[model samples]
Target: MTAITVSRAAQIRFSPGQWLTAGLIVAFLGLFLIVPTGTVIYTAFVERGTGTLTLVNFADFFRSELFVRSFWNSVYVSAMSVVWGTVFALPLAVLTTRFDFRGAMVVQTLGFIPLIMPPFVGAVAMQLLFGRNGTVNLLLNDMFGFRIPFMDGLNGVIFVQSLHYFPFILINLSASLRNIDQSMEEAAQNLGSSGFRLMRRIVLPLAMPGYLAGASLVFVKVFDDLATPLLLNVKDMLAPQAYLRITSIGIADPMGYVISVILIVVSITAMWLSAVAMRNKDYSTVQRGGGGMARRKLTTGQSIVAYGIVGLILLLVLSPHIGLFLLSIATVWSFSPLPDGFTFAHYGRVLEDSSVYIKNTLIYASLAGLIDVIIGSAIAYLVLRTKLVGRQWLDWAATAALAVPGVVLGIGYLRTFYGVTLPDGTPLATLWFMVVLALAIRRLPYALRSCYAALQQISPSLEEAAENLGATKVRTVRRIVLPLMIGGILAGFVTSFATAAVELSATLMLIQSNADAPIAYGLYVFMQSAAGRGPGAALGIIAVILVALCTFASHYVLERSRRLVEQSHGTRH
Candidate 1:
């Protein structure tokens, strides 16, 4: 009878549970992500009026000097940003990881703080500090008798992007350095390699994979960014041009679709090349156990120089935050080293009039974050636990969202869902629910990564043990797996929520009214008016605080979970 049951089960293509889970994932990704992205690509190749395939869009893009320049401008900015960002990052990573310093943890923690704020949120404040008539230039004028255009046009785009994204390089390089087997370093040293020679010969090439990963990310991000260029008033770049062509010329414009396709292609290509370049290159080492690259304690002079360099970089990186905080309360802050006066009326007005933004952001970002972790948890389970065919493809498809620019996705969503309405008679695009959906789709990759990493850490025996105790798979997952994964799920939620709260491009396209705008849109609106700069700065501060609080909460949950895990292990042992 049992053999007959097994034979019948073998005949079935999938169990009921597997079918349900896979079906849900396919539907969710299909309805929100795959369909929209497909619509954009399809529209790009066809004529708007005739709906016939044509090469005119590609031809026109290359023929027009304006479009061609914008394309190259994106490439130039992304390339330069990666160069400058690596220059900032490599030394910082080396300093913190290769030497024992008292402030290493602080420096490491503070380095990543720049990523927590959206780029355009700091644009106005950066203009106040780095623009021709701004604070640094005024000081430079007083000292050197000349002003430099640090924040001028394309130059400013590279500067801001490099400063913000260098942390990616730093974090990746630091991890790669720590993970390196120490035997290679000692072998190189025994061969008369020392100082720069050691790093040049042994370390750099081995860490090349990490560097490539970070550099490709920097290029993709800067290439697709629309807000920084718009805030800096550099509209000749591809992303800004895409925005202008769509918003100004309307969504029917073929040039806009052409720009979107190009952006998506370039982004995916950069990431793919990075992955391919490192494949089969084997950087493994024979070092045993916990041995990593050796750390050397810095001499007093070296320590001082390291700290000084760190201090200088931190000052430059934090300028936007300090300037924004001051500007939020300043009555007037123009053409001077600092503000002339300050007040709290901006905050008061924000709380009084624009508070809906804060509330909606809380609702929209929270729901998006919750939805992302649920999806992430399911995907991670299917990929890691099951023998299901094409399960890893679920992970690949979700992570592919990283290569998709938010602006392109925004255009995709608009084109795909323009006329769709809910049962309540409200257009789907106009609902706050759409904002939540869009934010989830954009940030799904982040949450999925976190959940996948967490799931990988758990032993499959835990589930087997649960099953041995007469527990069903659903019961075991609900009672055992979810609890073990709470820390990572919490982390995924915070990252998704914090980043979504600051999403500009998708939010700008889908948001139906002022009543529905989030804090990011509020900041954008206030920054546009000269008189509204104070309120804008105030809104920017709130955003920074929101992100900081989310970060803190994530850390707290993770720490507590770690302690609990350690306790359980101790009890078991």
Candidate 2:
């Protein structure tokens, strides 16, 4: 917060190395984030054909019937998505946190599984199960001679998004519930509140901060999603329209920039709304000598009901993974309760035809993750350790990426880097290297948070001691601070890599050659063809495994880090 003045020791602690590092960070942020964002804002107000600054782009966008419809559709779908996200998350958070129940661990794990897979990856499989001519529809037709509009048009976007993103709500709510004081519950129960009524009136209201945080996050994510809407053949949404305008028409489309501006505005508004909602509320119910929320043991009837509810939710949540597996091996699955046949031929076919996508994903995502760490570590050090001017601005700028939709970023690159050609006369946007850069830009926020957190745990006295012992500032960081924070840095890298591997919206636009596409783009390509889904499912399975392995590895590293921290404290004691 407060700027540090240059004292004798402070001047000695700062070095040429920190100066150079801070300069590089500013340059990197400006080049990647500030430039593209500035370009978008500038171009949105400027007409391309006349090269004149005017508001006609906004006026024309307002006049277009399709654009108006798309604007409302995004608003309507994102609102519905947040509502469903709560529905899916609240009960599960309640059951797992407030009661002792069977399959509690399994339920939590299942709730998370949906999030590991991108909704677009499962859209095709969901179609096979809930599409008009798919298995579920066929079964319903035979049983009751009617079908539900579960996957119809924009409804499909809401359905897939609710399932995929509800984990945000569950995770945040679970934490809030855990930190709640037992005295509040006791007081409420003493006043004739019990069971669901107790939770609804007291517990839920108190957890509003976490609930609103997760809900706003879901709204922002759903509003910015491009792949899910495209997968469902619903292109009227703002994100898809932006992509279509940029790539399908031309890079000079001002309307695309206008859409990007709107997306950014909407995302920022959602986050602001969350903050505003929680601003004046006093949620502190903790006591100086507080106890805990006693977990109630379920009665036989309660146990059965809880298990039934959890099982049904798990089935619904896990349908994407199950559907993907079944579809991957199915020979012919149309209009049938089961596939006519099963085989590994799809996996074989994909491996034989195009395994390069998988390899490219690994290469691009890994490198992007590495780049994230480099910048994350630097920014963390500057913000936390050094007295660099406006260091907080670096952190703020990176976090701002969360609100910048991938599709918007993609279009921005096209606009900013237009006509920039490579050595081979190929455009810069088409290069695999640019995709890696974009991925790093998009994921740096995650890694930066992790690194900043890790550095916060280490005391500055340690670094000062190292400096007093004649260690240079660079050596102090390399030898003292980094060793302590390596575990968190590793976890951050894995998270960035896993997320980047599944990224589609940005990758789809940057990829000019089919040969250079990543696994997510491959998944999209496969789903486009009736015969290609089998192979797509096989690819989807591999992507899921990659992410799961990374998640487990991150957990392991973090656990090991905690142990190391405990051991260090023990030594100090």
TM-score of each predicted structure versus truth: 0.96, 0.95
lDDT of 1 by residue, 1-573 (tens): 999998777655566798789889989998889998888888889987999999888898999999999999999999999999898888778888777867788888888888888888777888999999999999999999999988998999988998888888888888887777888888888899999989988888888877998899999999999888998888889988888898888879989889999999999999989989988888776764327678899899998898898888888778888889999999999899899998999999988988999999999899999999999999999988886778888898888888778888888888888778778877666777878888999999999999999998889999999999999999999999999999889999999999999999888877778999999888888888889989989988988999899899899989999999999999999
Query: Lowest summed-lDDT stretch of 10 residues in model 2?
Result: 1-10
Candidate 2 RMSD computed on C-alpha atoms after optimal superposition onto the true structure = 2.5
Angstrom error at residue 113, model 1: 0.7
lDDT of each: 0.88, 0.87
Q: Write the per-residue lDDT of candidate 2 for residues 87-159, one digit (tens) a residue.
A: 8888899899888866777788879888778799778888888788777888899999999877899988898
- Report how far residue 376 has shifted in candidate 1, in Å: 0.5
TM match of model 2 to true structure: 0.95
Point to the candidate with the largest lDDT: 1
